[model samples]
Target chain A: MLEKAIKGSKLYWGWIGLLLLGVATGFFAYTFQMKEGLSITGMSRDVSWGFYIAQFTFLVGVAASAVMMVIPKYLHHYQTFGRVLILGEFLAVAAVSMCLLFIVVDLGQPQRMLNVLLHPTPRSILFWDMIVLNGYLFLNILIGWVTLQAERKGVEPPKWIKPFIYLSIPWAVSIHTVTAFLYCGLPGRGFWLTAILAPRFLASAFASGPAFLILLCYIVKIFAKWDPGKEAIQSLAKIVTYAIITNLFFLSLEIFTVGYSQIPSHLLHFKYLFFGLEGHATYAPWMWVSVVAGLLAVLILLFPQNRKSDNVLAMACVLVFLSTWIDKGMGMISGGFVPNPLEEVVEYIPTKLELLITLGVYAAGFLILTILYKVAVGVKKEVDA
Target chain B: MRANRRKFLKIAGLATLGWSVFPNLLRASEGGEGAGHVRWGLAIDTKKLNDEVMEKAIVACHKNHNVPHIPDKREIKWLWKTTFHKAFPGQMLDNMHISEYAEKETLVLCNHCDNPPCVRVCPTKATFKRADGITMMDFHRCIGCRYCMAACPFGARSFNFYDPKKFLKSEEITTQFPTRTKGVVEKCLLCYERLDEGKKPYCVEAAEGVIYFGNLNDPESEIRKVLAERYAIKRKPELGTFPSVYYLI
Candidate 1:
């Protein structure tokens, strides 16, 4: 099965070459950053974290999206997701790998990551996040490998695999929830110290992850000639519709609390994100784009006729992915840092080096995603024939 | 009081663990809370902090610690000057023209909060509260995540973004205190080495009556006496971080 990837068309090799180029560029930039230290990046003391951490936050949600398919198939007994389930699980594995890489690139001391394990401070949310993220990755791989082997052999998956599959449902939610706790519990960061952040993270992850999966399935249908099924794509679109609505609702709840209370510390970050703080409105355009894309996705996804059409469905999913990508990748993490601890607004803009490293991580994820999808599609194509 | 017992147990636990497992590890991790028997604190009289004394005190403190003089983009400061309004934005008075302390330049450093959010958020135990309540940073252990910097409410913590050694004039760099590396969070450690040697803090010695230093847990100490006599105020008192620094306004 692994050898199947070696035999590919010119287009496949070209895609791999493009991703390889991104990885090499990122690696070159990272070596310089390692020697010169984090100063090479645009992050300052005031806005401490930059592109790496923001992308990490967004990818964690994408990793958690695997449970969207898991819940529908195992819990709800939805047959439509049976063929699509492996794709979501593989995405989780690749997404989690990217999340881990982003963290490494973000570190001022990446070499000292083992300190979390050695020291093992349970009180710290970062310590717990490490545990859950790795645990989620482990569970997904075990479930995916064993189940795929059983499918190939035309036999039932072992009884032992069932319990792990069940356990993964909650484990998926925990990864993103724990990640949110990393931001939420800090006392001074008023933008992040909200109760709704974890719920909001889960809602957005469910929408965006499956929305991307919808597009991926279409790509597979066109390129690999693997039509997962029309019903499968439609069912996932419905999930995206409800998930985005809930994500929007959780965001409004946050807005209401911040707006009604009118506390300067609490409301200042929202002002910075949406309207720009102290005339640094660089993030405002991106945030407003998210708002419009999100609203448009919801409208398109809601109507029965629009959602059923392949063209509208494709457009809706792209908008949904972009909407959440900006919300989580651009706004969620940095928004917390806008007004630094002293209530001074210090906006962060990513340097070219930072963007290069980020792109490198995304390319690595795509590489993992490409290989895994190729294997899954090959296995499915053989079984069907 | 509860935190005292908790920190003591943690130290004891870590001490025993270090003895059994990581004796070499403890040697590198020496910047623990200073003079651990009592809660160390300060009470500063703003009226006494004249321009000459403040400048002398700041210089002494920075010189003793090898605190680098870097550019604005990559600044690394332990003690510095800020305006009264900037230091205490929440406590600003409407009629600044009438208030004596309104326009005064405030001496600022790490608040060394009783409930340090930095210690709580650090992935590694690189930064932790010692039993005496002085928040300590083991630069050896700091992964430079800057989570501690973000968690600090007073904007006290600074990261060594660039190589500080690059900017320091060789003659000016002190040999006594080790300069921090390029990628680690550092802050006012309340002069951990000086406190260990039974010497008064450099700033406290230079300022004379302006800066008062003593054990807060000891009721008979001068800082406690100042707090009892003067209406001293800590920055952002309502936040419940229980900052050890107090100002005799």
Candidate 2:
């Protein structure tokens, strides 16, 4: 598996090199942040969490979305999704690893991070988030590797792995739900106080996770000269279609509840995100882009004709991915902070240092994705040969 | 795929059962530090809390705790004065006439809730409530996640974004309360250091009969005495934090 990534086309090697460069740059910025404390980033007392935490939230959904493929294949006995399940599992392994990194970098005292484990408080949602995320990562790595080894050997995967696979389905849902509790359980932050938050997180996760997988299959097809089969892609597109539509539907529910009730504390974040709050409408434009992208993604996927065409389907998948990224990664966390506890409106704009660090994290995730996909493809190609 | 649905069901059920049961085992381990003491609380008489009196009290607390006077963007506070409109938004107004309270500011500090949300949400037991109903922060254990800052409804907590001593006078870093390092949350500990020495809180000592601190559990204590006689209110009482502090408006 490692050897497969070692041998690659010039483009593949170039991409890996670029990602390494990104990781190095981000590591440098991280050192500066560590030296000076969080003041080096754009965060303040009001906006305590910024780019790092938002990315952590978004990637947790992406990590959880690995189940969309797993559920259809293992539960419903969909043969098409079985071919692509390896891809989803690997994507999750990468996403969860990235999610962990985001948590590490976001800490004010990285050295003291072990304190969470040293003094575990299960009452704290964060304690549970740690438990579930690491558990999911280990589960995916074990299942994905064992199953692939069995495929290479032309034998059925071991019986022990089957129970773990079934366990992962619920485990996936728990990872995102526990992450939602991190925000929803907090008493004062009105923007995240809704009962729908966990469901909304799952809905958006189901959309973005599978949507990224659809794009990834094509990337595998083009670069590695391996096709997961059109049936697999089409099946994934359908999953993304429903998830995106349901995600948008959930967003509308939030809009209705927050807008109609007109409670200033509850309404303020939405207004600040969609409109402006006391002249600080920095995120309004980005929030609107996400809105339009979400609606357009839903419309494109609903049509069976567009769903069949690779170009339109790819476009729709990208649209869903982008919009979900902005909605969760940018707007949701920032919105919760604006009109902070004191009813004071303060906007968060990520510093270059923060953005560079974030870019480094994404690059690292991709590097893992590339290698994992390479290994999966190598094993499949060897089996065919 | 030769999958037995029943076998899968058993495995899935057991795994789910394991996850649900494990956290409770850990949660049951959590308990307050140093049991068996009366709960401490504050009773503030707003009638005696003028702008000058509040300023004097704030300065005294800062001097005692070595709180930094940082720039507004990076400001940190433990005890401060805010207008009644800001502190008690959408409360006690419409039918009731606007008394002198509408214009005058109210003194505020950590409510040190009987159920502090900050303590509940902190990933580490860095922030925990003492058995005496005092909320305590162990700066050494804090990872600076700032979840406590978000969980606290009163805006009582502050993060040391910069080392607090940077803005403090050289002499202000006193032996009374240890200066907190950067990247840890800090707030009024109800002068826990002074309480240990049997001395009154700096704010209580500075005020003349305006600030009262005593055991809430003891009916004979000053805070309980004030609560018995005066019409008092705690900030956001409807939220049910059970704030140990009270205000006699």
Candidate 3:
């Protein structure tokens, strides 16, 4: 099946070439970072985690959103999703791989990463995150491959595959939940201390993941000349609509609590992200863009006529993706660290090397997604013919 | 022959279980010695801390530990000075008659919490709580995730963003304690090395009478005596970290 990836059009090869270039550039930057240590990045003691961690947090939600397709197709026997379910699982595979890569690159001591496994402490949320994330990656790979293989053979998938498929539903939820716990369980980080963080993570993940998938479906329509089915795409748009609304609602709840209570520790983080803390307002513009785009996306998605038009729907999906990307990828991490525990405002800005490394990680994820999607689409075209 | 083999297997299984449990039992006994017997603590009298005394204490600890002077906000610090309002945010009221105390410089260091959030969050157990109530770091085992830095409420922990050895002159580097490498989290260990050798922490000795270090568990200890006589407060006590460091206002 990987042979399909190798035999793509000139355009496909060019895209692959660009991605490989990104990977090379990132690798070059990473070597420099390794030699110079994390000082090459913009992180200070006050804001210890920067861009790498934020991307990791955002992509975990994307990885876990594969469950949205799994639940309706396997559990409820939804036939519209049958053709697109493989795409979702493959996306999970790519996203989880990126999540893992981001973590490795972010490490101050990447060589000593095995210490997490060599000396596992059950008390640590990171330990559980490692287990569940790896487990999820394997589960998706096995389930996606076996099922796609059965489809190619025109035979039923093996009975043994069912339990693993069922397990993946909850396993998908666990990946994002544990990632949320990594922040929420921390004692001093008031921004992440809310119990609603896990639920909010799921809501945003369901929105952004499906929104990205909707965009991918259109790309497949143009490039592969394959429609993933209008019904399937519409269903995903509905999921995105509801999930983004829920995500916004969760944000409001956090705001209300912080504003009403008037607690400086919790309120200051919000002030830093939305307005400005002390004199620094680096993230305020990005945060407002997320908010306005999210609201506009909801309005577009809520109307049936607008959603019925493929062009408008695609526009809305892009907005949804951009909105959640900034919310989680830009705001989530630095918001927690800005007003350092001692009430000092220390801001973080990513260096060029850091941004290059980040782009490299995203390129690596897309490379995987491209290959997997090519294989799946090739098989689907063959069966349809 | 069957009966003898079964009996031997039983004994072997019991021995294997005992070997596994034995280390935990030994650890429990070792911890028990200091559990209720010797909880190391410090009490700082802010009134007694002048600029000269605080500077001397900071210099002494840094000299003893081989901590680097990086000349940036990223500099590694075992002990440092900050204003009273900065050290204890939200504790000072705007209309208070003692508003001048808000600007007063006070010395701060690792609190060595009784229940350390850093120990709980560390994936490799690199940062751990000692039986004697000092939070300790195993630098070799650290993977440099900085979760400990995130978990610490007092901003006490610092990550080695750059190799610390570069900032220290060879002659000035102390042989008394090991200097840290790049990509690890470190903080004051409450001078456990000196305490082991029947000596006080460098800051305690340097501060003259401003800083007090002794066993909080011992009723007759000097720290307890100071706490009894002075109105002292711990930083972020509401967080339930139960910090061993007390501040005398």
Query: Which one wins on DockQ?
Result: 3
Candidate 3 chain A lDDT trough over 10 residues, lowest sum: A1-10
**Regions of model 1 farther than 4 Å from truth:** B1-36, B93-103
If both were scored by DockQ, which would come out higher, candidate 1 or candidate 3? 3
State the displacement of the C-alpha of residue A205, model 1, in Å, after optimal TM-score superposition. 0.9
What are the per-residue Cα lDDT tens digits for candidate 2 across B1-249? 247888898899998898787976655466433344679889899878888889989999988788989886657889998877667765634437655575568898999899889998998999998777889999999999999988998888888877777788886578857888889998999988877667778898888778999988888887887789998978887777899888897
DockQ scores for all predicted structures:
0.53, 0.50, 0.72
TM-score of 3: 0.95
| Colliding pairs, model 1 | none
lDDT of 2 by residue, A165-230 (tens): 999999999999999999998877899999999999999999999899989999889988999999
lDDT of 1: 0.87
Provide the lDDT at B164 for model 2.
Answer: 74
Chain B superposition TM-score per model: 0.84, 0.83, 0.87
Q: In model 3, what lDDT does residue A340 have?
A: 91
Better of 2 and 3 by lDDT: 3
